[model samples]
Target chain A: MQGDERGAVMKPLRRPRALPGTATPRPRHRADRRPRSTLRTILALAAGGVVATGVALLASGGTYALWSDTADLAPATITAGSSTLTVAGVAEHAVEELDLTLLAPGRSVTTPRPVAVANTGTTPLAVTVSTIAIPDGNAQLAEFLRFETAVDTGGGETCDLAPFAVAALTGESASQPPVTILPGEEAQLCLRIGLTADAPASVQATSAVFSMIVTGDQVRVP
Target chain B: MIKRMSGTLALVLVLVLSGAGIGHAYWSAHGELTGRVAVGTLSMTQTGVDGLAAAFTTDVTEVTAPVVVTNDGTVSAPFALSFTGAPAAAEGTGQSSGDLGAATLVSVWPAADAASCASVPAGDAPDGSTSSTGWNAIPPLLGTLEPGGSAVHCVRAVIDPARAAPGDTVVVTSSLTSGIGSWSSTSTADFGQSFSDDAIVSPHSF
Candidate 1:
């Protein structure tokens, strides 16, 4: 015991001194390692969202206009022209205006009279002649009545086209072809109407009326 | 930051591929359209030379005249030659010999384009099929006549007087049937026998 006490009393007490620029070990706390706010994390997430939205918008914008085109179609229009005809004159004179209205069986009335056919319209017309009314149902009565046309022969009233042609309203006009009249054109022709000697008694006191039908067509633009 | 950028790039790619699956499709922007018709007209005209003023007789001589039929309408017409008002005739000499029914006629056309007829010999009847009951058979000579087209023909008859009787009284009418319409020339043949024999030359003027 006396030796231990003497050894402890003889031990030297020496302390080490800290030199300059020496680094000292520090305590690392969990809280000290972390950033102060969540601003950095929020910025990172927002950047990722921006990239996603950009890609979506670019893809969709291009797809919509790929197969589209436009053009201007031509327009169409339609119109109509006038068509008309008139047969009012007799032998170079207007019959209705002349007021000469008695017809005799033996003599041909209006023999020297020239009938004028006028076509007044912008377009041409096909004119047709017909008897709207005739003397009774006895068609034979019409056969005795002669309707004749004359050309401008020096002698006058003579038909050179065909000799002795007779038009007794034998429904011949009903079978007649249409006559063409040019726009603003007119025709003056000789007409002769008479009851032949063979006319029957039934034909007496008979009357007739004539009418003209007109037709026209449209011309297309070239 | 780099890791975040890379994660964002991957997320964008997934979104793009899934766009169609999420009801995405191409969008497009949109138009409709309709001509004219009218009825046509037809017309015809006819004329004769020297106006039929003379009576036909058995003179052993032929009478000739230029006759023209015109298609004045806008449409083409196929025409038929025909006769109207039956005429009486007798082939024997004396009063009965002047029968116009026995007489034959020739229609010779001028300007080939106007119309056509059989090449009948002079003083001979025209070489064509006769239809005393109805319309005569028209040769292809007269084709479909267009507007402004004309049919020209010379109607002639050769008869010998004295031997050919003088009692024939007939009024022969030459007619053209085009479609439902008809045109006629007024010409009469009188054997100097009777006024009834005279061809009542009637011109159906339009």
Candidate 2:
């Protein structure tokens, strides 16, 4: 009976009865269903292959050139150059305090020791008066004070206060006309500080304390 | 799947562009130095006063003193002279109410020498004499003096015989003041404090 039940379950799947008066039913093979399933599998594999190809092209920087030329040039060992600016033998990031006593109204005083701005680096630098920090209490004195800068080119040139006009320290942070120094070279900077003749009486016997920051930037040559 | 791949590509491109934007840097070096400057001073000194005291009588009623003023400070300023004090009668004279100060005439003039200052005659106004009664008079500016400069001035006083007794004695104190602009006072000594100005550059790394 189990053999007969197995044969009954497989009989319709193995062969289907044709309609009446139709031609004799052709024999159907199990291989007939394989073509459709094989085609679907191939389509899925093709889609996956296309996606993978796209990802490969995108990942390789999208270089579409099929041919490229090669050049065998000598490699360069770049030695990074340095930029250093020093004032009075003192390097940057350091503070030096100078005392300029006996400043009188209608008179100007120059630094006894000329400020030496030296370029100790490997590259040329452009030096400039960057920022001036005047204490809030001495702001009034700053108004009456005049500052002048001159570059001494070693030709008997001196710091002349008569040529000093309205420049730095007159409510301005920096002065104009930046001085440039070559590598391993130094420049003498003369600063003349003058108290105007019309300075008020309140500024007498008072002190003005301030800081000046000078900056030197590396000059890049094209 | 293609849409998702495009989204991934766009995100990667954004990251690459952002990395390129922050690649720039600069090299700079700076030095900073501080400066301190103190203003000079204005002052004068009464170096000498010759014959400041004198006895007066009805026959000889005028006296003169040579006051020497020197600018001892670092600046040039004008100097002025002012007098303060009242005249008093001699002790036990019972003439305490005698008003000799009211009747005395005080005058100042720039003199060439001490001898010439002492020789100024009574009842005669000398050249450049600031003649006035001591009461309610503005101090006279003698002259401007540069640093270490000196000036000699004669201070003469005369008594009016009609307004005072023979024993009345007037002692006057003189004050010397030096002034510039709005600042005026007695002499101020130098503090002798020293200060200086300087600057430095800053160091920067790239």
Candidate 3:
């Protein structure tokens, strides 16, 4: 009975229907409709890897010139003033030169003070200087007194009174600059003395003994 | 794929850390304790004299300081010497000539004036400033001067005896600089040479 009914229903269905130009529809595919797990995983992983690579490149790309600068502040300065002399500050100016002695005697000759002493002190002080030193390890008052005097426009004079052959500064005196401060001072009442000239041809034998005695208590240099 | 990705990420991180480490190291570097005059003979002779002294000039004329710059360091360094009135000599040419050079050369200045510098210290770093104790007028520089290399600089400065005193000193300074280090040398000469009223260019026939 099933075959007889199927035969009767297929009689019209078996007949060829002709249209103008349309082709017959192919059979539908079940496999094409299914989801692909492997492909999905691969694409997700590829996208993640690309993102990671991009992040890495940004991290290492450019260089920034990171630097720091500082102002080497000029050291505090102290100058010599009038009757009132206050020890304001101190500074050091140093220069060093080296020479090759291949042809002659290769000696590192240092001409510490080639000229007269540089004007290291700040304030203008009218100082009448005398030479006092300890010669041969003994305190003595030398006879020769050399005074380098320059007339000041404001009645202020500076002199580096050196007794030609004295070596050390041992004792304190009223005529010379003071070596020690009384109290309430940061540094001693010292004068700014430097080697004025270039390196000397021959180093002088005599050591320098400057006995600085500040007369006025309130002298401050700019 | 996961393994490859992990490897690449690890490599990238390592590179970044390495670069930072280098920069930090260089920034934190410090200097190691390494490191390290004459005058006269200035005169000129000319025909005819001014009415007073003699048929020829008889006054202190010029101050010439002949200097030899030597490099004593173990490493090679480059150097450049600058002056106020003259353009510096080109690299390897130890002398400057003519007015352009003379403009950069220091002429009339006090011995203690900061404008007269002679030799630049040896170094590769840029000075950008002058040394406090060095020759004063011109700013200082440390280009590069090789170690053990020596350069000579001469200043032919004429002074008028009528105006310039005999005992006065004319100072010239220069610098020799190398990698990160510099050396300054100065020459100061007393004024006592033949005088010519007019400015004469001496023939540096070397």
Candidate 4:
């Protein structure tokens, strides 16, 4: 009786028959089991790969932390150097009025006033006469005016008209080499101003007010 | 391909930024100065005119006009004088066929004052002398006058009996012009010579 009860409880592995007029049927158990097993294997592999990558990243982080070292440093103070240029001992960007009075036609007059360029900063500088600006309604007069310049590097030399043999127009750059000045050093600049003989009658009794800008660039020296 | 392209673009951006960071760096400063220049004026004026409006007679007569020239401008300038006019005869009068303007001789000379101008001898040419028929050439520099200075000049007109008729009348006009005579240097040293050491000290503050 026990053996019969066991036989009834266990079902037999057998293939089901197809309905009438149907094609040959596939094995449903085998096909469904194969697809489920393949999906579970792929999920298991993906989960294992993720866990292994996390372990590797943690190990790398732990290694870096174990090898790292730090040291304390003292505080440092830094101060920047300065570059400053002055004309006639005047401050930068300040308009220093120079006296060049009684300019006549057909004659050249050297200003009794001298232009002294001084480097009053902590660094050396290269100086250049950058620009000249003429006032309104004086363009005609500027055409006839000529200028010459010379530099005296504190050599106890007299600034005279001999150095002014070559002249240029007011709009043109002065034909002189760039002057290099050290800190606390000064250079004397002489200017000879002339009006051409062909200056017209209209320029008579007319006054021209103009400005000159000088630039200084810091130079590195060994 | 997209990953490779993105890596290449990142590299190019890094190179550009690095290049911009390597530009030159320096400190710069500037100064400015102003200059005022005044030009001297060259001009003159005719303050007064005398002796030019007189009538001439036939008998070798002389008339004198004292003209005054003033230097009105700021600069010293030299002056010159010129004359221009023509003689005309009255209409329907018996006077004709005579050139009184051509025959009339005019002379000019500088004098200390108007009163002294009359004392200048006739036919004396101090500055210049010309005929009244036409304009005279610009004469040599008569004299130089300083600013606001004046000088009296005598203009004498002489008429000859042989060249004038009874009804002939001539009017003369004189013009004065001033101009720059020459250029001179105020420097005592010879040109091209080294100048004396004259130092121009700059003020400490503006």
Candidate 5:
């Protein structure tokens, strides 16, 4: 029985015969016409444009640059302000030179050798003084001599500090600038040099070159 | 499919033209900053000065003379001063190295305008006072020199009575200069160029 039922379900079905007039139904009332029109062309073009625009916007996240440019900076001419520091008052020039010649223990030079610090530029600067690059081939003499700095600005101006230890006078690290000088202004420094009385005989003939350095850091131009 | 392709091509052309049109309105502006910095010079002078016009004699003690240094430039400068005024060929009859006698010296700057300078004692200045010239350069010192920063010097010139007899004469001079002197600077001098930004071409910012 099941085999018979399965054969019936699998049996092919046949279409009913169409009436003569219905066989070619669409042939009736047909006329000469184009499959596509100008309207269709316009519609296709619109669709493509929409798709292209959507893709562009989606890819770039709706961002576009109008105009951009970059230019390098022009070369600047920097007129460096000069810090003119000169030494004065010596025997070659006056009496100060003669007093500094002999380097004996307990020897002291109290005479003022005015070291003038000037800001010879169009700007102001913070000035610092250091005894740097002082020729010191003889370590003994360098260690034996003690130096100090004092200041005198014109009318009775005096600054006396403890003697700077020769050993402590390393690089420019020991310098301190407590003053600011404007352009065309100047300050005078009175230098004092001395030899340690306790220095041993080892430093007898040793010599050392001496100098004071005045550095200027330019201030904002007003 | 062909119609769609044609539409895509048309859209692409439109987008390209629009982009070109936007760029056509592109504008540009320029900004500029300029700097012209020239380092200034540091100079000083000490000529035709005096150490007490009271005259020079055997009885005078150490006194001070005033040295006034002026900076005529715009900036401050340091000067390496040296006492270059040795006796130059001795002038006339009073020209003698030991004529001024043995004397010790010290620098004294008292007050701004006043000096504690040394004199040639009582009596008369050297008969060749006009002949003795002071230095144009200062002794090179180990320090700073500010612009217009001036301090009067009292070059205490004290005669050593034990080393000299009366009636002798002496002549000396000194001055100041900026920087150290090698064989070149002390004896020689050398001499630069720049163009302004406003010279030519378009008026661009500087």
Candidate 6:
């Protein structure tokens, strides 16, 4: 190319080559001068990620519970029937109450005031009365006694204090009454206890023994 | 460059370890039910008395309440007896400790009168009384009560006097088993006179 004082005469300059693994340098842009904002954003994101992770861990810590497999147990014990038995098992209805109590002495009490038996059974039971067995020595009161069963649909049932063989307290005294119970349910029974006149002063007694035949099938135990 | 890479790797390692620790803690608390023990099953018996001879009678002179416990789950759950509504004058001791296969009875009633009865509590009771001779310290094992079966233990109740007069009756309350957070209803045993027995009383002369 011929060079003149004012005439066009220009040559291109060569750029340097990059070394191994080095990226070729380019012209600096406005973004390169202000990279602090992007670095700050990355650090903030890391911190937020850690905070979120900690919160998630806290929310799920040791949390557990059960849903099904709940079981209900029902026990039935018959005292003054043809057969004295107890039945206990798991059932569907929720058991409300099972209670037992003794009747006190009173003269006006007719037929050994009907023992107040409560029925907490989930389902109503057709309660019947039958003589189980007579006390070991009282073969005399056997003739004047008869038994009957009355169902109290709302709460419980009671045993008949009649003069039939199945009666619970036909010839019994008022002091201690007979026990009336709800089969397959929990209720109280009142028995007429005849404290013998020829008893010891301080007998440390345990439980009473009554030998009666069981006729109805209401006793259960699981 | 090396410093930047090392920092990132350390942070990742810490995060992974933290995650694992949280997972472990969670697993430890909410693990599955791993055990069950058959506590016991009770049988009922009624006997007849021939005579009414005493004022204060003891019905349960001997008792044998039995129970069975089994390990049904993968983990072990300890067992215990929780008593509710114990009578002040009641006398009786219960087995305090047991294992998967064995159980022992503890005595309670007829302890030198009502004062001695205080020494025996109904459920776990208090810890001040004399320790039972056998199976006293083992608080039911921490084991699974087999899913289907049970670990059995027997408890006995004995009555001192054979029979009581017409005016007296005895009330005994008890329960033989319990679960970790649930409760079984209290079982009751009663002894008293019936209608026919009342005839034994001498009639009032008119």
Ranking by TM-score: 4, 2, 5, 1, 3, 6
Model 6 agreement with the true structure over B1-206: per-residue lDDT tens digits: 44554566567657656766645211000001011111222122111111111122232223233333343332223343311221122124432211211112333221222233333434432333222322333233222332343443333222223232322222222333423322122222322211113323331111
TM-scores of the candidates in the order shown? 0.29, 0.53, 0.18, 0.56, 0.29, 0.17
DockQ, candidate no. 1? 0.04
Candidate 2 residues A1-222, lDDT tens each? 598998988766645577799898655877655677567666655665566556555654566788999999899899998888888778633223334345666766666545778888888788877766676578888888776666554622455432433347634645556667888888776666778877887787777776767788887654
Clash number for each model: 45, 14, 69, 1, 62, 111
Between candidates 2 and 3, the one scoring higher on DockQ is 2
> Which of 1 and 3 is the better model by TM-score?
1
Clashing pairs in 4: B51-B65
Q: Candidate 3 chain B, which ten residues in sequence have the lowest lDDT sum?
A: B26-35
Where model 4 places Cα greater than 4 Å from the true spot, the runs are A1-80, A92-110, A135-148, A154-162, A165-176, A192-208, A220-222, B1-23, B39-42, B58-60, B76-78, B89-97, B121-144, B162-169, B178-206
DockQ of each: 0.04, 0.23, 0.02, 0.23, 0.02, 0.01
lDDT by residue (tens digit), candidate 1, B1-206: 66766876787788686874556332111000000011123455556633332344432234455557777654455665444333344435424333443443434444343223334455554544222311122232344567678777655443344333445444446655555222212222222221222344322121
Candidate achieving the largest TM-score: 4
Per-residue CA lDDT of model 5 for B39-77, tens digit only, reads 223345543244322223344443445555554433344
**Candidate 4 lDDT, A57-110, residue by residue in tens:** 454443445567889889988988899989888853332333234455676666
Q: Residues B99-206, candidate 2, lDDT per residue (tens digit)? A: 456666778788876678757666786876887764235265467887788888887767676665644444455677876544555842110000011122121111
Expressed as tens digits, the lDDT of each residue in B1-206 for candidate 4 is: 34544554455555554644546788887887667666777767664453354444432356676777777777766776555554443457745424445556656666778887666676565654433422233243266788889877776666665655544454444556665523321101000001111243221110
Q: After superposition, how far is residue A212 of candidate 2 from its true place, in Å?
A: 4.7
Q: What ranges in model 1 sit over 4 Å off? A: A1-222, B1-34, B49-53, B56-60, B88-98, B105-107, B110-142, B180-206
Candidate 3: stretches off by over 4 Å: A1-222, B1-58, B80-143, B165-167, B170-206
Give candidates' CA RMSD values in order: 26.3, 16.8, 31.6, 17.3, 28.3, 32.1
Instruction: Give the lDDT of residue A205 in candidate 1.
Output: 43
* Top candidate when judged by lDDT against the true structure: 2
For model 3, how does the per-residue alpha-carbon lDDT over A108-139 read when each residue is reduced to its tens digit?
A: 12222221211223333333222233233312
Comparing 1 and 5 on lDDT, the stronger one: 1
